[model samples]
Target: MAVASSDGEYEDDPESYHSGDSEEYQMDHRPWLERTAVKRDIQDLYTVKGLYNPSLGLYRYRVVDRLGEGTFSSVYLAYDSLHNLHNNVYWLPEETKSPVGNLCVETGHQVALKKILVTSSPERVENELSILENLRGCRNVSPLVTAFRDDDQVIIVLPFHACDDFRYFYRLMDPPKIRAYMTCLLRALKDIHARGIIHRDVKPANFLFDYESGHGVLVDFGLAERYQSPREATCQHEPATRSHLHGQRCRTDDTLTVEQAVYDARKRSRAGEGKVGFRQEDARPAVKTNRAGTRGFRAPEVLFKCPDQTVAIDVWSAGVILLSILSHKFPVFNSSDDVEALMEIAALFGRNSMQRCAMLHNRTFISNVPTLDEPPESLASLILRLNPHLYTPHQPDPTPEEALEHILAVDCALDLCAKLLHVDSTRRITAAQALRHRFLGNAEDDGPDEQLDPTEGKCGLLHRWVDGQRG
Candidate 1:
């Protein structure tokens, strides 16, 4: 690591050192060798310090602080010393433009340094890098600055963004603010999903939102993978179509309904159909699939271990975030395992919906929970139940006009939430569709409203919404 002087100049040679304003020079007036020895010791001290606040990529990046850490990688807040010294900004690639007309601009000197641990396989690291490179300049998506590897440790540099913690402000946010947050997130997903990438992990922590600026950046591609089509999985020779691959439904879609699926599952259980003896062991191996994501945010398909996971999983995770905002809860689903997670979903969506969801993926869902057997609770009812303050008129209550606006906003948000969190992955709203939903202020037939600003360019509507909420 290189050391800098008090004036912030890199000292490459001790011979060139000049104590222009040092009282130490007058006190000691030591010989050149003695002075050099002292300077060398100081440099050694800095080198030791660098072990903790390490520089990377041949001392181009200087660590400022540790941002976060996880099982696979650690992130550091770093200063791009090279860019800072050169007074240059990192520009997006010419071909890397947002497909949905969102803005993409140059990044500043500060960056986040993601250090992938040796525990991760080389293939996984390569895949993550590839996805980031492909997603450059996508709206609201974190673009890659650069990446390098020194031996077994790999470091990826990304533009650093300042944002509030989701837990701190979720309860305080109004419906309009939630709209801005989801708009940014869904825009990011739209861009990534367009490229056939699935962000397996989509949680609040991965999205950095600065309420003051009303801008958010979606980060972390460690668990991201390319979407594998169900058609390709079963029949490789068939050419893939956009509709068939993007949100492919299971074969049971035509035959199964929530009511019928639930009834059949219960009837089979009562008749002991497909029940196997405890001693009847088979030599078949258990089916396995990638089920990578945060505990509460994983979609039903992921929990059901569906082999044909698609980009819909990301939308489901985003829905969970929206659910959190509406219900005034940071984590609406708190489960230790997949089974518990499914039960939590069933509790809200009803076992009937869960059964239909299971059948969609060629699986059976049977639950003994009496409460879940009841009809699914409407999202509007659930939101009001969890957050009664939204509906109750209290002190400082708004006028009739204001109250109506609030109700309408909440209704649109709940409708979008329902669409995004649909039990069937194939039927869930796509990121592009979510952006155009009335909740995000882009209804297909409706003309531009006050939410849009003509001068803000193609994404003016979204930009205005964000700007309007800025503190």
Candidate 2:
């Protein structure tokens, strides 16, 4: 029997930052940057050279700020001189943080540049690069516009998408605009899955919305995969009534539901020890090697716990993303390691074994991993709750449902959430089914929301300075 353990850099419990209604917002308890020092060198490459495209006829561009950073690379906001004097944005290396910040504002185009570390194994970099390269176009997926090569590093260029991944926006919005979050991303994911691709990492941080365009564009295709290495799924027999995000008043002092409180108790129940359901079946095939993806979002099939796991994995993560957005970005489940990941999933959804999943074979799955002994009911319940103020659940008209109707709506949303989170591998919904989910599908298509693009015309950060622009 093989024993899989965490690399130790990860935390056992998720760091809860910014309880929105209060002063604490945007605290960095767990930082992805500190874990990787080599990323600094990756940024150095941008200093010597930058993205060059003959079509733009650009010579020089300047960067403004950083978008986000991770173990392998960091994306920056920059601009290309050739793009023009309007809003231009570009992605630069993190090393360029100092130089780029010092740069004079030449243009106003904002571009998202990805910097890949040289020390990273070539194979790993290739996987990330391939994921991005394959996701070009397809509306829902971020388009890879171009690429730049230095002596050692590989730089990827994507349009400057809005910074509000679902989670980040949830915190910024007052009360919250929940339904919009689900509808927009669901549409985008539908487009992506239709094109034979799976966005393995379906967290809020990976999506961006152009309020101006009123279109939520999915970004961060780093962990995406081609249609071939996909998942298999089927519709589950679930309760019809669930929560709907229509209209809800927001207040400063809101408390968790009985379900929500129970959920918290459940997670607290598992401290120090991991392994909710790290069965030997999930011990990974003897032949397969290489691990990718964040702990909480990883699918059971990826862990080899369920051999037939498919796109439903993305659906499961998407469900978590939806709940996180509704709860102001608190991850539905925080598993810093592989064993903890299984436990988190199994506890909430129940654990399953690969051998058992295979039994369904040509038939539908009617099973899952065993539930954690004495699992806290509140953990999944509270974690399952979605505030309509944020998500705005789907409804017939969404104008009126009376008080009971309102309560029914909340229950409906949580119910659908539970279905998506079903521990049984076969029971979970796929991104495609999620698009047609009762919560998201019931509402009439809001069609092309009319909001200003938070990232309008800001693709390169090289736009001409307003009058006397800063240098």
Candidate 3:
């Protein structure tokens, strides 16, 4: 539990801003001269800081401090001053409202006001808002409170989720806690994927988790987009059906399947006809598609420049998070660029598998590293090497049954990890399927009791603030 703050400037005490002696209270019911003075005070605090000008929705929200700043937007912690006056009703466009109306906002509700920068295109801003509206009421997904625009500066209001930093508890989380974390994340992904949405960015930073209460919310849909299949082209090859890229066990004799053998024979025949090399006279254009995602967490297909990327790419990124938890590493793949990222993946899955993966996208992969020629290491071996304490008992003398149970739990987690990290996009586990995985099937029973609503009272915020100090 941690109260959301930026640079220790976010004030959690509502009285500090709403006291009877303060200008805000006097402005509510006072003489014209006094009200004008209060308005000037508000303008000096908000407009002068460049958070929100008086012409925007400044009358409804009072800016406190900045929460975070990203490439496309800056988030500020603010209080909804009009929520109490409106009887806890949330203001939304008529077409955007549900049958029961938008989610209610309490009096003095804390919210994260995300101001989209002018550099972002109008289409991009609209797309992000449209996606958020469609995903309203989805469990574990942050709900949009409201949005306002004034010329180029736009503010999208979202609930301020109080949670601990991932870096503070990633290594400290036990197996059961990890299960709960993945379960919440996958549930959010399942809801969005069912609607054909692809969360291009699915890293830990985008997922806020209150580890003590076992609650989490997926936020920041800026990079999200609907999946659209590309039209079939003559130059594009059909996806490989029996590639070793999925990490399936091979036969002891190293015999190839009939379909693979026939495919290889056809390739050799084409090579004999001098059709393998590049043609100077060819007129075909290069394939290009959206490649918007964070590095290291990107899927192999994304690195391979696959034109028909799908929701499976998000699943791969989730697998990277799982790998980090298992290995006690924040970033399992710390590559600087796409080329280096692909090379890092090759070092784990090996070069032959990488080549077959490239064939899926009608591309070729070449690596000069000698070690990549060998078979890939098993996930269990990698995890054990990184975190041997997972299998070893901490006490001086532990019972046999205790050790066996620990080993079994680790095995279950590794199995799920293997399916998630599968290189073939078609074979990668879906978020829905992952929810049923053995490792996370008992997540509800394993985690802490369900937490109270974060916006109920000052208790939630105070509790989180204490947790933050302790952390």
Tell me the spans in candidate 1 whose CA falls farther than 4 Å from its real position: 1-58, 84-108, 230-241, 244-265, 271-284, 392-397, 443-471
For each candidate, the alpha-carbon lDDT, in order, equals 0.69, 0.49, 0.67
Residue-level lDDT of model 1, residues 135-172, one tens digit each, is 76578888887777766767787877879999998887
- Which lDDT value does model 3 have at 246? 19
lDDT of 2 by residue, 290-334 (tens): 245677777655554432334556766767765665465476667
lDDT of 1: 0.69
Error of 3 at 390 (Å): 1.9
Instruction: Report clashes for each candidate as comma-separated counts.
Output: 0, 70, 0
Better of 1 and 3 by TM-score: 1
Record all residue pairs in model 3 with backbone atoms less than 3 Å apart, i.e. clashing.
Answer: none
Models sorted by lDDT, best on top:
1, 3, 2
- Shift of residue 269 alpha carbon in model 3, Å: 18
Error of 1 at 49 (Å): 15
Span of 10 residues, lowest total lDDT, candidate 1 = 231-240
- Residue pairs clashing in model 1 are none
**Where does candidate 3 stray beyond 4 Å?**
1-45, 48-58, 85-107, 231-285, 392-403, 442-471
Instruction: TM-score for candidate 3, please give it.
Output: 0.70
